[model samples]
Target chain A: MGAWRHFPIFMITVPLLGAVLLPFLGYVREKWVPYASLLPLGTSALLGVLLIGRIPSGGYLSYHMGGWEPPFGIEIRLDYVGLFLMLVVCGITTLALVYSRRYIEKEVSGGRRTAYYVLYLLMSGAMLGFVATGDIFNLFVFMEILALSSYALVAITGNRNAVRAAFKYILMGAPSSIMVLLAIGFLYSVTGTLNMVDLAGRIAESGFTEVLIVSYILLVVGFGVKAALFPLHMWLPDAHSIAPSPISALLSGLLVEVCAFALVRITLSVFTMRASDLVMGTADAVGVAAAAAVLYGGIMAILQKDLKMMIAYSTVSHIGYIFLGLTAFTAEGLTGAMYHMLDHGLAKACLFLCAGNFIYLKGYRRIEDLKGAWGQMPWTCFAFALASLSVIGIPPTAGFISKWYLILGNVEGGKWLYAAVLLAGSILAAVYCLRVIYYMFFQAGKEGAWEEYWHDAPPAMLLPVWVLSLATLFFGVFSFLIIPSLLKAAAYLL
Target chain B: MKKVAALLFISALAVLLLYVVASMPPMGDPDNPTATHVIPRYLERAEEETHTVNVVTGVILNYRGYDTMGEVTVIFCALAAVLAVLGRERRGVIHGFVDRSEVPASVIVKTMVRFMVPFIILFSVYTILHGETSPGGGFQGGAVIGGSMIIFTTIFGLYESSRRIPLKVRAPLEGAAVMGFFLVGSLGLVGGGNFLTYAWPRVAQGLHPSLVVWLTVLVEVGIGLGGAMVLTSILFAMIREEEEIAPAS
Candidate 1:
């Protein structure tokens, strides 16, 4: 337990502790706010790297809070799945903070920047906690923290559109959050304990299968809304698109993915352990929903006109791929799904950061407006093209590697329909992403639109964008390095 | 049509929820999983292991302290969220509460609130301090403290109340709960147990034997202070709306 070096608890607390201190730092010295925010974040990221290496290859590191063991105190469990996602969360967050140093100043007004940093720290820390915790109720607590912060982050700009978007997000998010809480209540009532391990055991021993099935449904629907699964995703495009680009990136890249991961954890790690027929039977239905999310999101993305809006829709489509792979439950599918989380996270963050750069520099958010934008900002367009290629599942990009596994998994699971749907979704992704790519590189905007002063976004912005974009390509070519661990994780969950 | 659709959806959810509730083991059934497995430990071992007379306090502050910490952070986050959306309260600007300096409140109302506020605050302090031994704990006491502030603001103008608890005073205090968790957890680490553990080796110097009780009280106070500040700050932030008013003719 102590061997993980207290990385699990400290990693989460450090950021939250930083969040608590931020307002005071701002009050005492306004200039120190961003640096103070970055210190805890960097430490968390560093700890994430250390902890990932320390966890036993196949086992988890679980430490009881207050030294009170299970069925009593909360436990912090850092497994491969949680660790993988935490790194994704911490890594992208670190980059985003670096990116935000400048973007927040420009997008968010002066007085609100400290609040932005505080909320961002809370949001990132909660996301990390959501993945790492082994307790069901604790999961809900972390979810609330992340949910609240993200809602506020969405509306932080306080513009009419941003506020309206956050309102819609809350409208969908709040009730679902309650549904999730209610489902936890249902579990606790039936099972007595809130720890995942204990609940799984109690559920098997208990006679209340009916209650368990209903709780499962509620969790699916609740988490479904949180993840913006196809039917419940009406809130995402507006919320993601209207948020500051970094927030749009964070929401799209990690926040929704964390919800999806929680779904996987609960359904696979807990319910499936019971081998309840009703739950497994319903899971196939969730798979169908995931497939629909894939196609629907793709079509919606293809239909989108605004740059961030299109990427937002693409996230809907990409998240579909992750869920599709997860529901397949084959080793290949799960591996691909897990891998998709990483690749899509990197590619999408890059896409949004690049989008932010375009808006920040050239003031272009529309595809039509992006024409000839490359003439002014070559590097950003290149990063955008690379990321778009990944999104479109072009060969040798991270997206293609994961898409390959997803299709393989679908086929392995004998879900040819889903496999076909996956391929078609990729084509649809190509249609929208390639369209943006073309306008950026080939087509010309209004003659004067190309004329601008600064060549590209400041290095602060471009650095994160390129780092993320390169990671996608790097992971694509070097998929071997990560896929093995993902497969092992998939096997563990299966 | 919209109303009809919403009603249909809600009814469907209601039926599902009702069904789930009905299927759960009867409330307080001696044989229920909660009573059989998780509850007995907390109820039976109230005073010894965790050193709290209140089982609820033991379960929250010691047994499942992490979640309580998260809950407190959630409250802190709510304040952050509000400020992020509405922006922070700045000095020298009148908030959303319109300036009522021209028309003052009645003497009785002001004096009554002024006198009542202190006692209310004092009770809140008592509740917080004795939380681990009593039915009440940090959250309940903190909410009351926050309620006291709201009452004060409603009676005395927002400006006067804001002046009383200025930003500089409450800003650092706002982080008390989280910092308390960190501080206590680190001390537990130093005590060679684990983070948030109450036990320490007996020593001649420093708080050792009652370390657990003291830490619990410490966390309770931190939560009460932080929660009160957060609720107050949120009101201040939301009410701290900014606009320029022209000088009166």
Candidate 2:
């Protein structure tokens, strides 16, 4: 068939092709990247919509390698789970690209602007590959690609702190990646194939022993570092706080969410159901991950001064909710975890975008320095308020709906203590969100004329903040629309 | 005492490296029982598939091209960092490190080095080109070729090296190489195969086994070019820095 007919492959290729072509665009004109990068992203976003439609009717779309059928050759499977993540990745990536036009101009010079777009596209391609790959080894390779580019992108600002932060990210990321490699080695030793579907089938036949348990644990710890789950989250605050704002938005919003999605996918589809069949009652090991992530992330986020770092720490807290919901081991828990991922992705993206615009315009990242910013940048502050409300689990925002399902799942699973932690996490969210809101609106500035203090964000940056802020409410108010599909996806896992 | 301490340290490091190598399976043992993972698969397919004999090259260029892309970028980022830090200095300061008459390269040495550059480049290309059939591929050949530039910079001045090869080109060259690596790797993701799998039937059908090997070679060339450029840039930057810290005229 024609190359155009399989939009799925093109979805991954177009951005990459755009990345390759981006450098040459500079030769033609300086402005070429802004326009050229959009077309591929726009096309990839369009393909995501198509994939979503195809998945329900098609069961699962697997593209076999060079005509090598599954169980031997690598496959790229597009079921509901993969498509949902694809939508989030593409949606947020497109917004981040639009945001970067104005945001990047201020942060990076003209000479390096082309390189920024190329890194951005490479990061996106790796994430897409991470989600779509059917082989376990391929997933590790893609994870490195994503991590390496992000390390470069995070440090692209050329500040001392940015470099330091990027170094810290690499230090943690390198170990995590190596740990993942080691785990994959162990898994491959047991099962001859690196294809995950085939491994899952083989794992089911073999039964869960101590060796399998250790591998599962390694996978959790390794992926957890990337996912920023609780204790392993030492790198997130520094990396997130130091990166340029739009990059921070993408990092907090979708990057860890992708990692979480992979963890959920592997735990359920690859490790649990089959292993549980092999060794009954041992599914609780998977549940413990959710517990640790939720508990640790919540407690640490309560203690940060810098606004960006606080939000970054909060990601560690919020990621816990996703793990907790998943640990419940019910379909409802899985669905809630999935929904929580989407909710947090939107809420966090909005918050970071809003925070970024302020830092760009005002030149201060301290939470206290943001006092009365609401008066200065009403649009940005408004976006921040909406996102904060969503994060706080306010009704009719995406966070609340996800939180509701997660709490219900906890209760359904007869884990009242976990349910209470979920409630306490919401309260902590309220505390932090209100602190930012209170400082922005209530506290006086450092004594200046309103105009002197005023700093409005540009259209390029403001648009993404508002769009994601709207999506927070959109997912919350209309949680039902996506719920059925998410439920169906979760059912496949359970 | 200092000499004794230094000797002990050298011995420890040497022993550690030796231990690691000893622990690893022997170089081309196809039937090494420990070689059950992807390495064995590459060895089995190396000559039959790509026509080369070097198993390490075979794996580096074709089987794990994507990994090499990240490795290339690591060197690239290091080069960019060193350049960003040191590239701003005057050429005079960069050139002043060497005593003018100390290491004058002989005419024969110059002629041989110049001749070696193209052959080195060609051999890198050949390694990547024949990765599927042989053992040596993009990364090994690229390192060897890139090594020549460092050799050139050492004997010649930084000015000659910079004029011969600017770090600017290295940045883009690295970016393009990485972009190409991902593009090929994504084919597996797109073609109904796993990540980096050559799964698209229509695309695979049109190609002969040799042609598939050719495509693999194209990817290796990108890796080689990128790898060579990055390593040379790092070497140049290091030399330039050492030149700066020397006594001023």
Candidate 3:
């Protein structure tokens, strides 16, 4: 009740303060900037871990801003779901910052390094705010913070393609923002308050109105563009691929997942009391789009020659899995979706970091160019292989656990076809991932090039990649650590 | 073909939106749900509770202060983004105008800008300070300050304006302004109020009864300062050409 309640707010402000300080720190001593940037994230991650321990015992914590109760002041709500996602976001950010220490210096110019850290911190802090806030309008504001920072990060590379991709991303992104704002305006008209809990109750009493339906559609489409749902995913691949590797890892690993989390929060919690028929129809639409994404992304990934692009496309497919699980609307499915989000976040980040290491060390981006990469950097190749196994849903890897739950949810929902699609998607994933693995380990090197570049990555970069790879295996084997929280969260939502 | 398809897609979306708009409750209906619930409490008690007469100001700066903090951060971040995209290194000279030394502004225009800038800044400060009781607030006031700075830059040139507020000083000030906002918000926590909570007992202790109003004013000042610094930084980033790159690019 005392300072303990302040942790959620600190989780956001701490990073913000650090980000604002970074430019000056970089000016003072460039060496200190990277390490200084970690202070806020590490603190926030520790806070997240502490909150996780306290939340299960204490129930959800809702701290009102400015000491005014809800429906009057802004609230920071920490439920099992929010805390768990915060842990994921903060944990990944901490690791990415560590990995970026050496990577940013090499990829970004000296003049731009401080701005890179500043934007990185801003993006992560904004994402934390996005997940932790309870007010709907507050969520939109945080969303814009993250979105703007991400666009700039995407273009930070300043290559022709990077700039073009960032521009395209902005064009697509602007409408999504407008749609979300318009939806908020509609909801506000119907209900005077902007609190999520209050809106849910009022929406139920108001029944299924056309305004509500319109808002719901707008929310989905708005968030869908951000989440990179199949039809609206054009901006993701180029933006993800062309970014500096660490930024790529963060974008592919966490940004889209956060959007999906927003989608789940809106559909399940805020619209829980909507007309059953409308819910079913919306679920069907989401399910079909997810199914299409799984197949389409897998096929596109197989066709991709660039390693980063392939991984980015595979993200589209993995996002499909998360959506597929959520739209199933069962407790098992919801839990699966949440678990998959964590699993994919870890595995994809590992993959992107590994890809980045290759690009950094040898400047090789093509899959065929990576022939005999294992001979050069065996540890990195091994990590990539491990992460790919998880990507393909191989057993005893984290991906298998989520896929298992999703398939079970599909079966429980009597959607056998979705179950088949899930299986087929895994096989397709296997095809794309195996191609990279095969070239990395088995394919012949380009004469003596392997031996010339045959050195392990720096400890700073290798450490985070290995930690993430190990986490993928650890979570796959010991799903018990996280599944209970996931179940509790799923139960709360459904 | 692409244009036709785009046209078709947009029209379909527009028609759908129009349909939804038609079904919405009549515009500004007093008996509407928005008017019935939640707002009355705000309208009636906002002044007594938060000690601010302007309900919108009270709601934004006190009741929903967290959102405003996020908004300030967003603007600060946008500036950071602009700096990131455009190199932080100052350009050797401003682009889009003849060298100011070679082509000085006409006496009439220079005198006019010299006459106008101080008043513009003065008015902006007035608006920011009186925001708790008036319609004007940090965002508008900060924009006005930025506009005046722009005027200074345009009339006197980047070199002269930057010399007045050097990049070295401006960069840290921009960051410090946002840091101030974070520090102020954190005061609520220190006082055992929730984050950004202005009316906590501890915060109000030894202060006036209208402490919330004062705190609201303080936050608005922080926001105004931060907004002005961010706008100035963004302008600096945009106008300055990279020293290494040729203007013809």
Candidate 4:
């Protein structure tokens, strides 16, 4: 029990320690750094699996820093939601690190290679810390750690477009961070504690004061930018698409989901005690915005010519579905949201990795240019096709299970409009996802192009994509294995 | 037209923020919830509990050291980001800035920088060590140390500074210093204490109060050293010219 209690802190600290050691190791043996980067993430993923087993039996575990009890010291808490998110974070990180080896060696060179791995590890550790920590201020600290690393990673390619995109990301991201900081300040002033659990009780006692409302708005806008919520999602396509493929996978897969999860954690956990009207009002607002995002993102994605850009836009649309589930404020809805976070994370990462294989092999990102990819890279295209089906909520894929739950929640909540929105979103998703599949497999190609580019990705990259795509199918078919835990987490929250 | 929309947006946001700020409890009221709820415990028990007189330091280093660790990692990340963006290989000529090697440093400025560097470093060490009892701590002390290096570079130029403490030497030092904080925190766990908890009962029984104090000092020093190196590196990366690009095809 004693040993298990420290696992949450270990999950975060180990990756961070690895990140700190990477550059030095790079200095000593540059060849070894990429492989060395795997150790911490692999360990964290192992711990995450262990934690999933334990958290169900133990309920939530909180490890206070410096042995001080909270509302005093920072706390690292692992509930089912946090642990599940940690699993996603650590799992994706391990895969991305493995996938990055060949991609980074080919795309990035010199000291930048070492910097790439360092930032990757740091970003992963920061995301893990973001989900695991219980203190609001500590969450902000971790958010900045992740945010800064992401901005740098996006720009690390150093082309003119990438640099511009990263700078724009920083410009948009900084204000959101300040807004979050200010919201934390407001919450601290009112409750006099940074602890989430303590703040929840205090906020309920204080009632829905104007100050609290302001804090709520600040948090929504701040985290909204990071989550790429509609109207604030300007930075997502450029930043996510322009980054290296492995990084794109991480950013699109884990980073935005973590932010969305943070939003869910704050609304459902910290402000649980607020007036029912305010809570419902916040939900309505989020529901409407999410509905808008579903339509907007789907339509925009259909308009994109570049493959990664379309996927990035699809991320925005998928985030809407998660929000719709979240704002439904029902157990089924929350479960659906959480499940969607996992499902979308796997599907989207697979798509990005597949797209990276295409780009690496053929040196093109345009959808039209990939007309005959299915002939050359059958395995990669097959993975992409499966992931796209999952994204579009085809039956017997993970996306279907989450969308089913989401529709059930909306129907149960008596919100027919959101249900309609979900349907529209699925239809729109089909348009973009199938469009890519069509171009990849069905479209005729220019002469000699098919044979010239006919090569499969290295095993390192192809394997992870296949694993993720298959997992989507596996979970969809056998959701009973995961749904009970998701339900348990939801029950704990509501 | 774009300017107009931007102006309207900024003004509306400012107005909304101002309204919220006005509604907040008046600045620094002692009886405010922030002061009343959890702070009293920090104020009353910090000295006896954490054994640090400066409650802020105690709070930052002991009570909330995890956040401080993340902060150090943030600084480490900033340096990494700068390097990733600017550290491309080229034909000896730096990118982003014009070469300044043609200009010579003034004799008096060089002499002054040489004299000030050692004392500045000494004072930074004092600040880091004395932080538990006084106001100055790792971040401030680190800036002072880093500032000294910047001064050295300014006087001696980037070439000399690179030669003196080349990136090869500095990068590892910074990594090690940042890792030191994580090591100390994990060591607490290894010693049957919680993460970053310096006052484990087992340790207190063995080494007593000095161990906690020493742990605090160790973290402060680590942060100080890492911060100084990171700042110096950022300065170096910024001032150096862009690496010369390959000739256009």
TM-score for each model: 0.97, 0.84, 0.96, 0.96
**What DockQ does predicted model 4 obtain?**
0.70
Best DockQ among the predictions, by candidate number? 1
CAPRI class of candidate 4: medium
Interface RMSD of each: 0.7, 6.3, 1.5, 1.6
Per-residue CA lDDT of candidate 1, range A1-494, in tens? 45456877888999999999999988888778987899998999988888766765477888888888887889887788788889999999999989988888888887889999999999999998999999999999999999999999999988999999999999999999999999999898888899998887787666447788888888999999999988889999999998999988899999999999999899876785535566667778888888898898989888888999999989988888998898887989988988899989999999999999988876678888998888889899999999989998897999999999999999998999999999999999989988988888898778798866438889989999999999999999999987888788778778
Tell me the chain A TM-score of model 4. 0.98
Residue A240 of candidate 3: its Cα lDDT?
93
Model 2 segments beyond 4 Å from truth?
A1-5, A24-31, A109-111, A273-302, A449-455, B1-112, B166-210, B233-249
For residues A1-494, what per-residue lDDT tens digits would candidate 4 score against the true structure? 65888888888988888888887777678899999999999998888787667787227888888788889888887788789889988887888788899988888867689889999999999999999888999999999999999999999888999999999999999999999999999888778899999999998788878888889989998999999988889999999999999999999999999999998888877989534777778778888889999999999999999999999999999889999998887888988998899999999999999999988877879998888778889999999999999999998999999999999889988889999999999999999989888988898877766765557999999999999999899989999988887887787787
Candidate 3 structure quality by residue, lDDT tens digits, A332-379: 898888889888999999999999999888888998999988988999
Candidate 2: which docking quality band?
Answer: incorrect
lDDT of 2 by residue, A380-445 (tens): 999999999988899989888889889988899898988998888888888888988998889887
DockQ of each candidate's interface versus the true one?
0.86, 0.18, 0.72, 0.70
Model 1: which docking level applies? high
Report lDDT (Cα) of residue A71, candidate 3: 81
